[model samples]
Target: MQKTCLAFAVVALLQPALNLWASDASLAVFEKRILPILQASKPSSCTECHLSGVELKDYIFPEQDKTFAALVKADMIDLKQPEQSKLLKFIERRPEKPSLITDKVRVEEAAAFREWIVAAVKDPQLLKAKSTASVGPQVSDELIRHARKDRVLNSFAENVWSEVGRCAACHSPDKNQAQVKKFGNRVSWIKPRDMQGTMQNLLDSGIIDVDAPEKSLLLAKPLMQVEHGGGQKMLLGDRTYKQFRAFIDDYVAVVKGTYKDAKALPKLSQEVSQVSEIWLKIEGIPKSLDKQFLRADVYAKTADGWSKERVATGDRAIFGGGGLWQQHLTLTAPRDSARAKELLSAQKLAGGEYLVRISIDRNNRLAQDPNSDFTKEDVIGEVPVRTNWPSGYGAMTVVKLPAQTR
Candidate 1:
């Protein structure tokens, strides 16, 4: 009993000294490892999941006591079980195929925080430390989620990937071998069904200018604001240009953390559209209107007159030489509607009688002001049509341009 009491007393007496040693050790590790992470110019492992708005450094501080206190106050630190610290778990979160360099950085970051946390928790001083300093992102959780890589990719799919068909003939690797030979592999920006790969390539190839999204090569080249071998594939304010700009602008804003609230986030288009192989041809376009841009909105003939919304739409410059205009139709529906859900898998228009409203941009107004749309004054004419809306240029539903109404 005496020896047991003596041993217990010795341990009790040495406990304070042991804790002091542990505190010194944890401080040393934090200074050498965690401090370097905070001081490094490059981004931390948080970027593996977040494109912006959060970083590992945000959870850390130069002073160990303040960092520990802030983390404790924020409920980010697991005092009883340091290995389960939220900070360490965050550092460990990584994508399935992380970049080799960033993966290495992630491993080092996780290990550093793990070691520091494990040691720090054993130090009573650290557990008792009090600080008013706050840690973590200053942005709201909505903004953080908006900036996540997955969210960004979903936006890319909606605003950019869906429109790649317009550029696929010259930029898709599977189809652009000849262009690849002439312009190099860089010309094959589209990765054939790989949305994430295509987005990464766009960023890597400098096609997306995050600093000035309007000046991005993807938009500039298509608009012919910069020299492009493909000529002008899109006008300044056309549907394709609008979609591209929407994604680019939002991406830049998210990366820069400029959106302060959910209300500030870009509003998603109320309508969802997908490019379809179904073709529409307008013949007998007056030769005088040659080269003028033309738009067609197809509305299903319902018992109530028209469907009140265009079921399919197409636009192209009039082939004045052929006295015609033809292009693939884009099926569209109000977002979250039953029809929108159906169109996701089946890009087709129901067979029925329909009204085709035609508008001609005779003044090149769309080229001058992208925001301007074909108004009632621009209506060339409306034609009643009947067809199954076939799916190829060889089998397009042809309509003669109505005599000018205005």
Candidate 2:
């Protein structure tokens, strides 16, 4: 009878489909087969790491290249003889004898994976496979389809040229205009060409950081009162500053191939009919998205007054705005996990009127920070959004909420 019972217990422990068993039944097997091998115990409760009590649902395993799920899908573990399973190989290799676990007593644990698996398979409280906590962030199917190299560039281009960040200004389209004009409409009055010379000049002078957007002087030129042709200081205001930042973002994106090419640019902005969730779309950029550099900031407001968050800060400047870049921010109740359960407790927010301020040092690296020379109290009209990026490159976006949701 004893040999028969031991065989039955081992069979149950090794079975693939059985993840949990009754606590009492699991304890019965643990007392007989696994108790003598333990070396030391852990401070963590026995059930925390064991299958009989808490199971593995609450625990998060380390990011493994080949996760247990893939292993199960590959049919590597045998359910009938769990002690002889490959999964048990890992547990048994622990530095303890007889018992597979290293922890000592007072913290009675699942000594071997065989013991744990047997308990898990029989436990009625074990979570279903779908409920495992090891899942990664969820991405939409549409976004996945658009992730092709060409489609990513297209989306980037569309986002750039919209009313948010108008690139056609300095980059003109044969619009007849006057020769040399004032600071406000210079791009509108001029033509577009390779800025390599301009950038090189700044780089040689140690103004811009080499190949880094956060330290580039080209990003800081437009927002200042620097000597253009005359000795006079010319100023680019808040609105112009933002548009210029958006332009650099596009320039970097296109150069990097985050935008597919000039041809795919227009199709990048095709508007969608519906928005079910927060949708982030990029298109028309070429392949080299990470090589270029740029910076942008996004801010939001709540009833408590003001709060801000940095949206993107990296070497790749793939995202651009149409001047009207729409960011759908969902503000949930503070740390209220129960808000999802209580319908009335959930706080819903639509778009609200906010401010977006951007500043750029177009000299590729000439102007020092506006705050350094000017008084800190005197809000320098150029880049009022107080976030730092590489020298010469900086951007800020202030969005206002719509009066009412549709």
Candidate 3:
């Protein structure tokens, strides 16, 4: 009787068909957030490193759903405590049990991935949930279908042209609008003549980091996370970054020999969409931050004048040059977790008249704080904004310096 009951519980967790996808949302979350990291992990060769000699990839998870269930059951994932997971701990570089993989996940990418894991773990069934849809075309399905080397370049040509055109703009012989010549000789991603050779060179030349694709110079140069003479061209959290990450997946696949020039890779998609989310594109600030960068002291006006909570802050220049700057922020609230609901409620109460404040930090020491009257050093702007925003919707707001009043 005891053995039978134990077997039944095991069967429930491993209930193949029903447990696999859970829903489109879960599948989407897994495909976008988890798949890239997993593909980079070399699960087929997990036994090479572990003392137990356990292979956790195809051996254990023959299918997508099984992998999802296995992650949850093995205590490798947790919704409530995402950062403190066994899987992350194993891969995190530290003095103890350092990750053996030459390639490791970036800190920002890891944090973003946790959001996806929590979403999948919390709601196995994504019903009543508004799973997200990106602003650009959804390629989650298309990627798995045509992830081969040659075909990948075609699919990538479509997606890459849309996202990384900035790279092509400066690097290509045709579009070197900036006349940036030094990199032109090393390799040209613009021409189609020697794509395999060019890409292989790009991959091997240290432009693309296999372990942390997000940290690759291909991405970092455009993102402003690292210094670029061009200044910041791409905002970190925008649709552009997401699209580029998607391309990285295929690039990694091709590099790792999982997909070749002729055959198609599996049409796998992982989603990391949040429930309540909003995007902010604040423009019209001086780009020449002679001393300090732009910072928005986010606040909500409650019944008692203003809410004490600091909703969100801004950093980095999305578009910077000629002494002018712009910033984009994606604000999200994941249901009842933390301050998500509070932000959602504040957004719901918003009127055509400004409900939030966007203050600029002109100096390194000056206070752009929303707590007190920002009449002195802080130049603030208020825009009539809407909230509880759809997946990829961004509020296009302007900032006029030296705001007239509080």
Candidate 4:
């Protein structure tokens, strides 16, 4: 009986300290990181979902909301076991699975918040918000020296050069954009215009870990395994992550002096033709005799949103110094014959419907301007193709377009 009383007394002594620590977490990490994601605007009314559980007749508007938010913070923001939080799982939802919360709570927005969540749980001082005074993780000069000497890293960077534009928005030094600078080497890989310099900086600064490439900050920051001022930019099991892993693997091989060129490697023959071949034919395009007309880029609506996943790029619709002309192109789309059946199991439909957006570059400049895309308003015309039951390859799917487009 004496021992039981002693235990109760000990618990009583610790309770107040626990409450104070929780209050700090609520004020610092909850307010600074998690709240923004919780408060993110939705496409429709949020009144139904974002409301307090407590019933009160005299409750105010946002004050009540704040009270509810505090309840969530208390429940969801556990300092002892951060990863097991139901709130985290609710946000990291998959499309095929039933979502705990609506898509309004973007998982991408959780990257920075998660970093704070993990850090603040362990150390209350880490709850402080990032500021201009905030400093980045320090890298070693020796690591940079060795990474620079690796020729495989060079080749890997060469392959990524074409796709460098994808990283420009968050990784550049432009004042208008967030200046995420990489240390070592004068060249700035962050620059959208300079891929080689960007690669040099990326390697020199240690974003691509040669030792364990998958753990590299390059992949982790974008994937949100690590703290990124930018939110989650890439999904874990997607093509983009796979691509980064492949390149980083090659870079590691180079770092260890065991690098082998991918082109020189033996080919593995596999009959894995999974995508539906699309036959796109562009006809009735007028080409001015004096003007140089260029090619067209085709974008299709895939499982990922409409703008993402470029399906094809057509040949020059109308060549330079030519009259009205036509061209044939083949595009490939993910084979969804089975999944389409499941999506519309009850209600019958022909095939999967997709909206294909086509943007033509009249000048063939190929977007010389760093800031512009091939299908910019100042450059050319756009055409839309709505395909419900798209025919197979060489089926001659025709996309008709107007002469002028605003």
Query: Relative to the true structure, how large is the alpha-carbon lDDT of every model?
Result: 0.87, 0.32, 0.48, 0.45
lDDT of 3 by residue, 121-229 (tens): 6555432333122121123434433533456555454335433334555666566644545544543545434444445555677777877876887778776778875
- Point to the candidate with the largest TM-score: 1
Could you tell me which residue pairs clash in candidate 1? none
In order, what is each prediction's RMSD in angstroms?
Answer: 2.1, 21.9, 20.5, 20.9
Alpha-carbon TM-score of each model against the true structure = 0.93, 0.20, 0.31, 0.29
Model 3 — which ten-residue stretch has the worst lDDT? 130-139
Predicted structure with the largest lDDT when compared to the true one: 1
Give the clash total for candidate 4.
1
Residue 223's lDDT within candidate 1 is: 78
Q: 3 or 4: which has the higher lDDT?
A: 3
Candidate order by TM-score, decreasing, is: 1, 3, 4, 2
The lowest-lDDT stretch of 10 consecutive residues in candidate 2 is 268-277
Task: Output candidate 1 Cα RMSD.
Answer: 2.1
Segments in model 3 whose C-alpha atoms lie over 4 Å from true places: 1-146, 149-159, 177-184, 192-206, 223-227, 253-406
Q: How high is the lDDT of residue 16 in model 2? A: 48
Tell me the tens digit of each residue's lDDT in model 4 across 157-222.
433543343455455556323343443222234755665556667777887777777689878887
lDDT of candidate 3 vs native?
0.48
Candidate 2 backbone overlaps, count: 75
